[model samples]
Target: MTITSPSSEAPDWPQCAHEADGRRCRGRPVEPYAACLAHIGVDRRAGHLAALEPGAGLDLRGTPFTRDLLTELLAALTDPATGRHRLGPADFEEAEFSGDAQFARVDFTGDVSFDGAAFGGGAYFTGARFEADLGFVGATVARNVWLDGVECGGGVCFNKTRIDGELRLETGTITKSAVFRGLVVGGDATFSGIEFIEPAVFMETEINGTAWFDGALFRSDVRFDGARIAGKAWFDGAEFHHDARFDSATLSEDVSFNGTRFVEGAAFPGATIGGDVEFGGNEIGGDVTFRKATFQRTTVLGPLVFPRLLDLSDAEFQSAVTIEAAVGTLHCRRTRWSSTAALRLRHAEVDVSDAVLQFPVSIAGRSHPFVADGRELEVPELSDAPVRVASLRGADAAHLVLTDVDLTGCQFVETVHLDQLRLDGRCPLASPPPGLRRIGRRPVRWTRRRTLAEEHHWRAERQGADGWTRAPGNTDVWGPAALAPVYRQLRKALEDGKDEPGAADFYYGEMEMRRLDPDTPPGERALLALYWAASGYGLRATRALGWLLLAVVATVLAMMLWGLPQDDPEPVSTGTVTGSRVTMTTDKPDPVNPQGSYGSRLSSERFEKSLRVVINSVVFRSSGQELTTAGTYVEMASRVAEPALLGLAVLAVRSRVKR
Candidate 1:
């Protein structure tokens, strides 16, 4: 192991040709020996170990060291003041350790490189501090690797490394960026309480054991895309100052992100979670997306405060999921829920368009804070914040329940099981425009009715109507024929809930659609038109009453002009007939029609008679007064028409006030 000059007779400098693990050693040979000190025989290694001094730089690249040999080298570099190995600049690149490598509490004042190194047994660097960058690129550890409490002033890289046993970086701090891309850990890996000052990349990394990242701080962006964790992954209390991407990652066991904070945004698109998941008590400053992700077990995704959007579009949940978020927008379009789910939100605009709901799902508006996982989460300061639903279009709503959710802009046209949807609390829908609006040349006053967003879009597009704003990107406008059934189903739902009064408006809407539907039969459409014009389909009491009053006035005027006699005739003895049988016969004069100068028929006496006759006709009663031939027909027509109008008015009143 002694250093000596090469022979002057040699044509070129000789290189060590020792081979191990199919790789030939390329270290410079010792002058007295054919191989470097690391690859030299054990009997000849004493001189190299004796030559090493504390704080010395060691270069063992491309060398192979046994456990005993490595110990002797480290012992030679041990500092007397601290009784610990103090290395200036250690380069172990392409080095192979045959047994356990112990470097615990070792201090490397200068840069350290273990790149392409292979450790046959456990490698310990616990409590070690590197003043500069620490590289483990392409390194292989056959057993556990302990890096707990290690501090690195510069960036740390474990890129493309493989650890067959446990890996611990707990309580470690990296001042610069940390790269773990394509790293593989076969046993449990702990990164708890680690502080990463710069961006951390873990793309395509695979951990077969439990992954712990609790209390980790990532000052810059962090990525774990395409990574696979076979066991549980705990990221509780972790903070990410910048964006965090976990796209296409796979977690086989329970994963927790509780109490985590993402200052920028986080994404998990196409990720798969095979076990239970906990995402509560999170503070996300920007948008968070889990689009197309799959959750195989129960998941609790809330008690979160999201300042921006939370997109779960195209996601699938195989088990029950509970979400308690105060997000700005929750997009769940095309999401599939195989089991029950609950959404307790505040100040969120939820869109569940085209979602597949296989079990009961409840979307409720929560005013108070949420208590989850033994933690009390605070809500936003906006006390009057409302949870509104943007759309239910193309959703199967048979098992859907809504509680205190605002549906003012919800589109229900393509929703399934609308009649079975349960609406609890004050689930408000959009109301039609107030007051009268001119449609074409005629003044049309829309009835105050709860309507769907699709209906608004349809009407707005059809008539260029005001007071209805179309939803963004919503180009599908349902026609009256399609909207008619939606309104009818909703009306039935309200009626079943014992909210007949609330159902009245929906019934009115249904009738309106039927009247306007071009596909409706001509005879049925005409009847519906008449029904609406006269009494608003038995839902507008004022309209019915107005028509009734007009009918009464017309009947009174007709009776005075032509349906009343000018005067009454007195009885007189006329003539004898058939001798004794007709000795004294009584004769009554026929009532005569009113003569010309019709204004005279408007006398107070005649008016009194006309008023009495019209009043009798309203009640389907005869006045028993003499009348002209035309007056007979007028009274008969009034008897049939006036009573029917009065009945319609009564029906309208009942419909509005029914319990």
Candidate 2:
């Protein structure tokens, strides 16, 4: 590539101003016009011919035609040497093509238009140059139309034009902008390595075949809003210096933005992609929005770099939504996700806020936790560096709304704003916060604690400002009314997302909420309290085990303090009415039994025996011994409460094991 500053020096010489493959030519001009020998031909004088001349075949093969006729110009040019016509015109409005139209290597120094014309054969404008605007409004090309390597100094409008065959504009350079609004392409339209210096508009255009835009560079904003493509759309390795929007565009086949870089962000809001949509290995400097977009098939989002916010608000996913990215931040408020399929987030480190997610999600085998600065989970080698996040708040989420969305696999590393959240259901929260710092008491001693989460938990669904104390959700103030639905949805989402362990956490949280709710019926609340106190809902078996141990300990202590029961002593051999003062009487005595005297007292031996009874009652077993009414009642209660608690412990263990 030769580096030449054509704009620095004065325009003295009229040379070949044509640029091929991004390099200007040094060919010397052969004419009074600013074109070289190759770019120039016999200068033909003609007024603005508004109508076609009376000829079946108009030949200007080597002649430079600079007329802006409103005639058919999309036809194949008649080979003057062979005197052959490619085809005739169709029954459309406007001028006839006299014959085939060809402008090979021709330099068009003036504006031109052949609006509403129809060509039966084809047209070739390969290596053509237009110093002014070029309009093909409402024209129809029945065959191939080659505009390969064309250069346009001004805008080129193809509005409402229809191309039946391939439309090639590879390596084309447009100085201004290209307008293809309402243009319809019946065949493939290739624009590989094309350059758009200004904003290009393709709004409301329809492409029946594949649309190739590989390596296309857009210096300014580009819009494909409301465009429809029935075939695959490839934008691999494209670069957009400004915002590139495809809002409301419909794609019937797969669409890829692989290796694309957007300096000003890209949007697909309200777009409906029928086939798989992929955005792998892209770089977004600004917000990449998918608001109100719908993906009927699988959508792969990964291996991308986002320096700014990524918004997916109000989007609907009919199938899987796999996100594997290094996003600076993510916003998905009111986004609807598929219940049958998954919303997988693998290895993503996102800073999310004001995100209302009630969709099933999976976060297993994911990268560390998703947390903003000040709320990062403490990985051994991880540092607490502040990362920029562009959400509603300057940093952290303000009011997140997870209304009717399922979020089963995600974790809450940041202190979430529970007050503003609206949770209809929740994912099982097995995820632990990275680390949190909180004020303990007196001198405001900030305590650092890491959440012991190995799974997902929806209550942990917070973004920014770490630690359970600082976390609005960790405040544990949401009443049963709010907590119930939140936990339910979270559990369902986690399950749907295939994060079972995470779902269990939300289940436990739900039961805990139930236990603490004062509005619950006293009986149900009592049971809930028992479950929570004994086992952390049927979700924490350790608590249940501890409750059993504590019960046993209490039973032992009671028996020790209240004294134990003893077996009846063997009767001593009574002497034959030895004396009446003591009223002692003895019967025949055996080795293990003897007739007792009328004198006895409670013994420590009996107290020791009573401890055995206590052990039996604690274990939901029984000691073969007669006891008082109170003791019987105590034994029965132990059989019911203690056994039930033990059962809960077993269930908790089973859940964990299964997970």
Candidate 3:
């Protein structure tokens, strides 16, 4: 066949153009050199070209294809009697058109292919399955490209097909490996339900819109690390082998790896998936990192098990996240994790913050259990991450409620600060493993008890004046007394008060005394000894007047000096006589003065002076009137008990004048 370049002067070709156009030829004779407009010009239809019979391997080696020639060749191939199906570089190349080109089912026996075809318009291969190893290896389509429900055998290669519009490879099957490496799509590229029996490559593709690989199965690695996507990239239900990577790529919209099965491994390290990463049910094999990648939205990775590490270091989540379950450790070191909702580190190994550590009910499966071993979670290398305590001013932590939770062998690294942590579990001791090294190597067992015991004691001390006092008076008097001597002595050393031991000390002393004499009646012995010790007198005085003996002596001293004296003859000094030898006078009998005031002023002054001398001398001589006076005074009080009781009754009645 004589292959020629289509000319502008030539009539329109009927093979390549749409048959819907009137330019379509009704009949076409097989001619090597045809002048019919149906087989000549750029406007010709591809469906009108006559089928050429195969002849000793026909070749159109140097023939360049115009839009008209391509249309004609395509039309000729549609005819059965034409006996020709194979076409090559002799046909379409650099084809230009204003509309889409549809090539429904048409058989080509030989290697009929478009090695470097460039379609200015959209191209469609819907249901027009290729039987042989079809090749459109370096095709470029200006508009959208569709190959829906098409089948290709012996490996199809569109290694560098650049599509200006959306590229759809829906429900297609590539029996062998399909190569689309370095392909560029200006719009979205979808490969939904497309089966690749061997492997597929979409590596290094630039997608202007979403690049969907939903429901596509890859028997090998499906890499997208170097692929640039302006919109969201979805791989929901896509399987990976060997490994897959989106590392170092920029995603402008949300990126999903949801339900993707990573049988071997996967990596998205340093890839910014500007929106949320919904890995709701993904199975990850190897280590994954969003390390230093910024997520502008929530990154939800619910109920996942990564066999190795999953580092989210320095990643920031703009919204809330639900990480209900995680099998491996999630390192969120130095990350700015803020969420309006409660940040759940439930059951997941969370390594962040310092201040205090609190486990959640979700971790315990009931209420939050206080595990003493949690303090070991603190890794000093991450000291910069301080726990954020929201405030404790008006908000009461007591109001926060919780449920029962288990605390079986949980480790809290450092202090886990929480806003409000409620514990309803039993007090459990810290039991470290045989091989694990304790943090700081602090006396783990002793320190655990000491810490908890100190806290408990401190709180109890605040609740009352006693430390861990079960009831108001549950402890022995001596128990408080032991503290009293020390505290009182300290307080007395500070204040200007008597150096005498406090009353609390007396009670404590009484307890010690009773302990020495256990056979004694406890109440009687304690009360009796306490009274005497408190009174600073002998036991006799203590039993007779209790503590009231001190009051009696004070009253007596006041009355003697301040009350009226007898107005009869005054007795002379017995030590001195009336003679010049200075003998002591025994008595002097004097009649009452007319004014009944003889020696009254002198006597009163002498009496006052004498009483002062006596009182001072007595108190100073008898341990400051704390011994003899105390006993005598208490005995005298017992003697006037009846009259005193009667007087007290009258006073009590009189004191109730208002009532």
Candidate 4:
């Protein structure tokens, strides 16, 4: 490729300026208008007369013409006629632009060819309508080119054209096809609102600056193969009726397809993006492919309504990416994902069918937690660091393999399948599924303290006690019963503070006590009685009441008998009768007046009556005396051993007190 010099400094020049005067030329003209006026179509060339024509136009509407006719007509019109030149089927096969020229509003009837033409100035084709076809194959432009509203009945080809300025195709409607294959532009280009009625091609077109296609509508297929865009490209509201191809292209800046709708598939195989790429709020009715593309920064395709596939096979993102609320299949096959900053994936419904998360290894002093569904995760290995998770709320997984996974404070609600080989936490089961097996081959042991409710439940259910003596429950069929010996032993253990409520040691003692003897020791007999009374045992309560009453009465009577000597007289008192002055005395104290002093021996009747009254009031007519202390029981037991001696002692004290 020879490096062409700038147009102004080039030495060889064949140029003709636009005609100003309608008169003849001043110098030696190449072909004078006076001599060529008859041959140049006198009627159509009358309006724009005295102006040098561009070239003869061609027409190939219903006829097949040779290449020589197009060449001859172009040669004849190069002599600078001072009027507009028009060519139809007379010159359709071949045409060239060897010198700098202008052909505004020239018609072409067939496929007009300019295979190797070089233009130094702007190629102005504004409103130059072509009925059949047009071609500027491999044309080169050193400056700007304009094709504003230039309608073509068939495809207009510009396979490789280099334009330095803007190429305007705004409002142009092509009937059959359009091509700008391998066209290179040194400046910006505009194709805004251009309607391609047929298929359009911009295959391998390199734009150095912004390429505007804002509102361009493609009714058929469009191709952009191997193009390199150095600046931002805008496709703000474009609509593609068929597939759009941008295979092997490179975008050095941000590219946007905001609100663009693709009716068919869009492919971008082997493309590289250097900056942020956004496709916000676009709708793709077919599949969109970005296979093997490298994104250097953040890429966003948020809030898109995709009706088909979104493939990102073999694509690498050096930074982060987010594809939020995309309602379609998301395939991220063998892609390297990371972030220079933080990467967040909140509130996105991800459908990972066969995705491989090629998680990058963490550098020194960095943290990375790998989290993906086991079925969706395609990595053959795993990380060794701790995985910090906020919560795993209702995630479904048949197999969860975490090799050396550190979960410091993780809570498990529903039943988690136990691992066959485990380490660090004491799981109750020994073996489970293969996927649940831990990396290490040791048992994981963990001890947890039970809450109050948990302790009560386990004790009443697992270890049966009196507290659980209600109607048998569903679990009580295999559970232990409330036995007295077990209750006593458990209470003793609890009082000694040697056992916690739910410890295994406490339960072991209770189980052992269930086989012990039922007869309690005499010191604990009172405790047994109190227990029966407190629990409202009616039969046991009656028995305990009778024994307690006998014990207390025996204790009080014995104490009173011991207080008197072996010859002690019973207490007595003397009083005067109301009618006669007489001292009344008895051998026993009056039951109602036992606190008075004894006076003298009285009649046998009085003495006998006093003794009977004392006996009835103190012993026979009363319920029983109250036992206030342990000594009272001991005294009563001793009195029961010798009841005859106690009766004699009481009678002697009564006789002595009366005398």
Candidate 5:
């Protein structure tokens, strides 16, 4: 087909005006021929080839070549010295090759372009050198395309192309952007040490074999969203200057992003990894998310410096995984770990709310740098913040272990197996509000105790008060009846750990809950109230001793007023003349109860006698003193109640100091 300009006559330096597939040729005409050598008649093509020498510059822009025609052209440019076709400043933009285009080891001393080109068979440019820009935008290769070790001075574009077989561009440097958007390789794709100076785009690309991108440097943003790799992908030691995205991508085999530096953030949300994943030694400057991603094998993600968040919300891990990092936040909400997992973090806030753990999982706070797998991860010096667990609501904690993690704001309501959960080191829980408070002019002092965040929220909501902070994202406030068992189980766990002192606070919390529980029977509730008021459920030594002292004083006063006598009575003899004999009779006046002068009855002498009687009653001994009916009953009651109070005081002391 021929395409001519609008002018009636061809101007000087006339254009070839050749066209095919809706694309017009831009090649210049050959002397003594109307069209360029590629578009000239079959008979004249031999004469043009005779005039061309090896390593000659060739421009066949928009040419449509059959298998025989391309073979003849390449044969004319064959260099005898290296037995390889050599070209200079070659341009095949918008060209169509009807058969296998084999240009292996072809050295182009200047710029080259196969841009918008179509090859019916395999296109080989292996070990070739393009001193300038290399373009293959909108190209289609029916079979494999090899450009392995092909160096380009400028940008490289294979954007929106398809290759039926393997495509390799290993160890090639592109000074500008490396655009491969919407590209598909039916076989293995290899890209190693390809220093992409500008943004690299591989969005919606698919590779059938191992996608190797090891040691690559992307000076700008890179994207790989909607891509699918059938085999393992390695991006070890790769660095991205800006953000990198692999959202919605799928990898069938093991993938490694170790020692990668993402100057900005990196995201892989909704991606699926069929095999193991290794993502250690990374430096991420912004937030990195793997939300909703699925990992089929063991995954290790950390030993890195993450300045911002690492979110794995809704992600699924099928095998064992370990993460050790100094990150800002690690969000694992709704994440499911089918096997064992370990998280050793520093300066990070973790939220595992609604997460499912099928096997044992441990979350620990590291104060200093730790060595893992023979490599020492460096900890940031500016912040020694502990790993704070913000929430564990709805989590199955049957096999969860926490070590030195701060839980001051962690919500534990609806958590499963909370009683069986293991806590090691200083796992700090929230403390009750400080100082005494009043409820409607009644002085109320809460026992200082470590409590859960859910309890705090419940109390605040129940009282409609403001001092207590509510848990984030938690609107369901449990009543004391529901919280009582939670406190009881936690207390039991501490007791089992031989932490009696630590368990003391939990015991107090349990009793408080029981006392406030509306569902408790009246008798039980009243009993709990008395237990608290007397000795704080046998955990308050001072309260028990105070009640004991009050009982002793009241007993002494009762004896002084109603039991001590006014004075001692002496026996007298009386003589009667009833018969001829003199008879002597002895009469002892009964000891009278103290009466009339209240001041005399309350004298120091009477007080001394009353104190002796009261002390004897406390020890369950008889004072051998006379008493009124009321005083007798008072002494009996004091003997039983005072000793019991003393015992409670001693029990409280033991509970506090026990190991």
Candidate 6:
């Protein structure tokens, strides 16, 4: 067939346009192109490559071909090797594979475009170099695709492409933007160690197998928005120099971001994770958000350093959620907690001044509470559901809002953010987790103790106290003005729950704080002091018992010392004297009978007589023969006090314990 340039003015035969070494190429031109075969044109290279096959396989490097050569190229590449050298890879460089054609690899040196191409075989482009743009729009690869160690001077794209097998693009360098929107991968895909100088987009993509981006570096923004991963996804050791996003994505299996670094920001808003998600040991420099996202399984974030902020507003945790280390502002307003355990925060500090730290978590499951601070104390009416415990331990938080929280089966360790906290439902009582040791590492403690000194220290610090100053009788750090409201709120919560004993505990705290309050009225302070000393505000039954025991012992000792009280000496007539040396005389006949009444309520010790006097003094009963005197009245008051203490103890104990 006659070959000619695609021009109406050309004759049936057209000469080549390229010349080398001062001689022109005598080859005919290919249609629709200016250059002829053997002169930097497609037809010459295509026809030549179609005819020549090495002893083993096709070994045509630097051979230019056109879209018509796509099928023949695949056939030649798939053919079995015959000779040893022929088994080598088919090479193409400075060749035009044309638009709408795709291959795996070559030491490419010129522009290449596979726009709107289809491939029935693998797409392995390992160690390829491109001086110009490498496009793959509207392409399809039926088998595995590999693009390792590629270096591109221009931009790259895989837009609207579909692949039936794995696709790897690791260890590549693209000077310009790389786009992969609407792409689909059937098998495992990797983009590790890649450097995208400009932005990289993977929006609206779908991956059916595992996706690995380990050690990948993005110099510009990278986005995976609206993508879906049906299998596991890993981003280990990846570094995003610019903002990285996975917003609105769906992950069906476990995803990990171990040792990853985000220089700008990372976002996953409105995303859904069906399996576990962990970002252990990651350093996120900018704000990281998971707003309105849903986690179906365990979500673990630890050793993560977010320098700016962390926003989790309205996020839902169906399972357990843990934050081990976060050093930035934590915005967790209006979060929904559906997990059967409390939210756990360990070794995290959220001290940002302008952040929204309200923990208005809406509890969902019956097994879990809204939040917990690893300290445990048992209370009544606890749930019997298997312990699904969650806790936030070793964290310093401020301006917190903990409304409608239930800490029935939860514990907190080193968490000190209860001050100025907003509340709503069952005020999160610091009671022991329910059903001890049944679930979630919740501990059960039966003994009560004084408030911890460190806890108070932190409280004082938050209250703007410069130094530690214990209350008059208690070790509370916050003065009455700062802590009285908290105590009252807690008391009201317990009272609303009809837990009088619990309310009394808080009431005791309130009175204790008020008693030491410098601003309190002097009369009120005195009254509060008296109340505390007397009944410990109706909470310290044990203290009242101690006082009763002390009173009983002390009264007994006093009775022994006083011996017996004798009726005022019987009146006897005597003479008066004029001076200091004067003397008087009296008759001795009235005391002649020893068995007669002595007019003194004295009893002997043999029949426990002294014991009788002691018992009378303790019971506040008169021993008879008492000629009224101020001394006798004091004894009577002492006798009444011991029994009152005993009664107080009994009442206090009965109110709390179900006998």
Predictions: Cα RMSD each: 5.0, 14.2, 19.5, 23.1, 7.1, 13.9
Estimate TM-scores for all models: 0.88, 0.57, 0.48, 0.45, 0.77, 0.55
- Candidate number with the higher lDDT (1 or 6): 1
lDDT of 6 by residue, 154-250 (tens): 7888888878899988898998899999989999889888888899998888999998888888899999999999899898888999989888999
Summarize candidate 1's per-residue lDDT along 450-535 as a digit string, tens digits: 88777888888887776665655736778898999999999988898898888888898898888888889999999998999899
Top model number, TM-score: 1
lDDT of 5 at 530: 95
Off by over 4 Å in 6: 1-111, 118-124, 140-145, 263-265, 280-288, 298-311, 320-332, 342-345, 350-505, 510-530, 533-535, 538-567, 570-615, 629-636, 639-642, 645-659
User: What is the TM-score (0 to 1) of candidate 6?
Assistant: 0.55
lDDT, each prediction: 0.84, 0.58, 0.47, 0.48, 0.80, 0.57
Residue 244 miss distance in model 3 (angstroms): 2.1
Order of candidates by TM-score, top first? Answer: 1, 5, 2, 6, 3, 4
Over 1-659, each residue of candidate 2 has an lDDT whose tens digit, in order, gives 11233233333443356567664544343344454433443332121121323222222211212222212232223334544322222121222333345666655555656555556556688877777677787777767778899888888888889788888888978988799999888899898999999989999999899999989999999999999998999999999999899989998888878778898898889999887766666656788888998878756654444555667777777776666444545565656656333333322233343443344443322334433323432322223322222222211222233322223223333324332333333322223334443323322222121122311222233322233323234332234555565566546655654656656766766665566566889999987776566666677777788887777666544443332322333556544443565455665332222124312222355446556776676563877655544455656666677777788888888877664
TM-score, cand. 2? 0.57
Off-target runs (Cα >4 Å) in candidate 4 are: 1-86, 89-100, 338-659
Task: Please give the range of 10 consecutive residues that has the lowest summed lDDT in model 5.
Answer: 1-10
Per-residue alpha-carbon lDDT of candidate 4 for residues 51-74, written as tens digits (9 for 90 to 100): 424433332211111233333444
Candidate 5 residues 284-394, lDDT tens each?
A: 677889899988775776665566888999999988988777777889999999999998887688999999999999999887765545675553642766789987888
In model 2, what lDDT does residue 456 have?
21
lDDT of 1 at 513: 86
Q: Judged by lDDT relative to the true structure, which candidate is superior, 1 or 3?
A: 1
User: Between prediction 2 and prediction 4, which has the larger lDDT?
Assistant: 2
Better of 3 and 4 by lDDT: 4
Q: Which regions of candidate 2 are displaced past 4 Å?
A: 1-95, 115-121, 140-142, 294-342, 348-477, 484-511, 521-584, 587-659
